[model samples]
Target: MADIRIVDVSLRDGNQSLWGAVGLNSAQIFQIAPVMERVGFCALDFSSSTHMGMAVRTDHEDPWERLRVTHQLMPNTPLQFIGTGLRFISWESQHPEFMQLAYDRLVANGIGRFVVLDPMHDEQAIMETARMFRQAGCKEIIGALVYTVSAVHDDAYYADLAGKMAASPNIDRVYIKDPSGLLTPHRARTLIPAIRARLAGKALELHSHCTIGLAPLTYMDAAELGVDVLQVACGPLANGSSLPSAERVIANLRELGHKVDIDDRALRQVCDYFTRLAKVEGRPAGKPQDYDASFLRHQVAGGVMSTTRRQLSELHLEHRFDEVMAEVTRVRAELGYPIMVTPFPQMVCTQALYNVIGDERYSNVADQLIRYALGRFGRPTTPIDPDVLDRILSRPRAAELMHEAEALPLKEMRKKFSPKLSDEEFILRATMPADQVDAMCKKGASKRHYNPEAAGLVKLLKALGERPRQSRVFIQQPGLTLDIRSAAKEAN
Candidate 1:
């Protein structure tokens, strides 16, 4: 088995999730780097070459001066930064040379480890990028398979792919990157072993999101299968868009007879520091309650909820809480409720329940709902009962629910969830008004119902009159606000 490693991707992936969250000064990166290194992370997934251009254009100086400072902060921990094979936005195309320029500049610095992020799942592109990096003298190159899933096949297919990927001479490591947090435990157990079998003499790492709340368990399974490295985010910034917890995973692995040398106490302090920072930054310290199981199902079923409070307010669907609840049930039947894919679904579902049952019983109802969902779905460790639900629903929120019920579409709602048809059928069924579908496609550059195929939708929407909703999906609290240099002095 390859020796285990941990790469703290909080700076790169963590910051990417947070909106306006990446302007941290060098001192900030420096401050966080040691804590991570002390916790036994092998490298820092520093920042993105794609987003770096934003900092570069906005500032007169090099935006990654913070990364240089991070080097000093973590003199020992290697720096592993990201380079993308595809640009996320058309805006990047406006400066077509940014990708190569960014790669050159990042390498010019002391960055030793590079994650060639192939968002399109194009192994050929990754191979070409690997060639370029090898030519650039980057010895430790990681090829990332972003949003990768073997759902279409069984473990054997994934294992075969891993073996083939391991044979690449230029690639040092293969990171199974699941940006959407979709990997399941059963699948992990099956696939990890298969991949290990194929890569018996090669290095393999697993980088996944906890979207389905499976990170902790999945990490354990991967370790058991002899994964070389795992990714993690530090703390409260830890869960939402962050990777699985490193200390927890390492500790769990050690208990299961694996050798890992992580400082648990230091990890705790780092978690505390970021938790406190999140509060100071005006983002809630704890995970948001609105993203419970129901909300996760909504997303999984290709249902998109408006994150803008204004849009939600305009819907005025409060009075129709029961109807929305009915819709939730129907959609669940169609797509499986508590899809249990999102680790934080309970947070969103609780908010949705609050809107349904009102504040009077919101907590109790939410608790019962989540508990029931968990138990029903085989995660019965969390305590929840209907009696407790009854108690918490007796407060002021009950009245709030009654008031909001007036605006809800009690009559127009569908009563049953049906299997999703073809791409055209999904768009026609999921969205209202053909014009709205076109408008949304134009805005998001994605198909109306498909999250992955939204490139065209994102562009079309931008071309038309609508703007894509600000993606707050993977953002952190205590968001980065200033350019790197300004934040450096501010941090000091």
Candidate 2:
């Protein structure tokens, strides 16, 4: 039996799938860092550009500081990050100098591995990102094949792409990423061997989700076909829409006569801590979900679904979710079925919601959709529907967009913005609004580390210690009653 290695995605994809990527703060991650470091994982899926943006926007935490602190705790382990080929975290493409400087800072802050993907399956863009990673001194660069079901994306199609990725000298590994959890065991039976045949003995890893309850079976099939690494998550963060549980995968592998090198005791400790932390924080724990065939239609990712629901709730349109979802299916096909991953899924869904709620179909198209039709994002795998294309292009903005010039280079951007700012600050300023950056800068670094379980107890004790002279503390439970009053009396 071949030995199988596991990459833990609890910190990155787990939180993304289960809690919308905004559930954990820097303090919470810091409290659990040491326990994660001891779990004997082959590598840790540490952070992503999305996670960094969420930190700055929602938690007011310095993303660079988060990386530096995480690296300090797990100095021996290789930390991995994910990004699109040209864009850092935003949907728009960034300047090449900005991309290079971001990569350099990441490596200097202790990121060792990068998983670069182009959502449009553009080979040149992926290779360019790989080159940038190499130039920035990253130790390992993994090219990603984003899996999706479409007429144009057959096994042969994927095999050809995998072959090209394997031939790239800059890429040390290739990742088959099923972010939507759509890969079934039956599909893996043929797809795995086809890609494996073209890999030329290069390392290949499988990263799938459990949204439809098919990933565990798919993982087994891929392992039988000689996949080198299986990406999984700890128990509290596993199953559901996240990856399969590490403990379950280990047991299944051993039952199948494969060898896995992991410390069971340490894994248990990590699981137990996270389980309690989820409860204390009032967050949902990952659980196995029954298969949902409707997922094949919308194809929204696990993480994107959470954010979508939140968005609908914010707009008071939660009741129209089913209508919006059905519209998404139609919209995806009209736009030529762009793979349901970051940026694309978000772009498609935004346009769909606009159509569903705007009182007239195709009356209000999003700017991103217009940009997509103009080939600003990338070329689509298949041709967009003619009617939809005409409607989008007929808009007056399309003419204005056609006349737009190229984005400014780094040198020009420096002059346009401020030239004195550091690359990190400049990049943030370029991507985010100045008010958001100012708010993040004002908050500064967090001083106190948070342990969810202990935090609740601390709050309760502090509340009990602050009783007024005339006030009495009352406690009543089944078969127990207690009352306490402050000893000091009010002066007349």
Off by over 4 Å in 1: 1-3, 18-20, 54-61, 86-101, 147-157, 286-492
Tens-place lDDT digits, model 2, residues 1-492: 889999999988999889889888888888877778887788899898888888889888878888889889888779999978677767677778878888998999889999988888878888999999999999899989899987778899899999999999999989899988999899988988899899899998999999899999899888888898999998689999899999999889989989998888889988887888888777888998799998977898655677778888999999988888988888888898899986788888888888888978788987778999998878887889999999999999888887777656777777867677777777777777788778888998865477765676667556778744435666677775667665553222
> 1-492, model 1: which lDDT tens digit per residue?
335677776666665554344534333455556676676678877766434443333322233455565676677778887765533212112122333444555566667788876433346666766776776677698766443332233566556656766788877777777765666677777777777787747777888766556667778778777778888876665555456765566667777777776677877877776655554444432132222354333443122232323334566754664455454443233222223223333344444545454554334454334333333223221223445434544546544443433211312222232444332223132223345434433443211121212333345445543423332222123642322123334465
Residue 263 lDDT in candidate 2: 85
TM-score, prediction 2: 0.89
**lDDT by candidate, in order shown:** 0.53, 0.86
User: lDDT, candidate 1, residue 217?
Assistant: 77
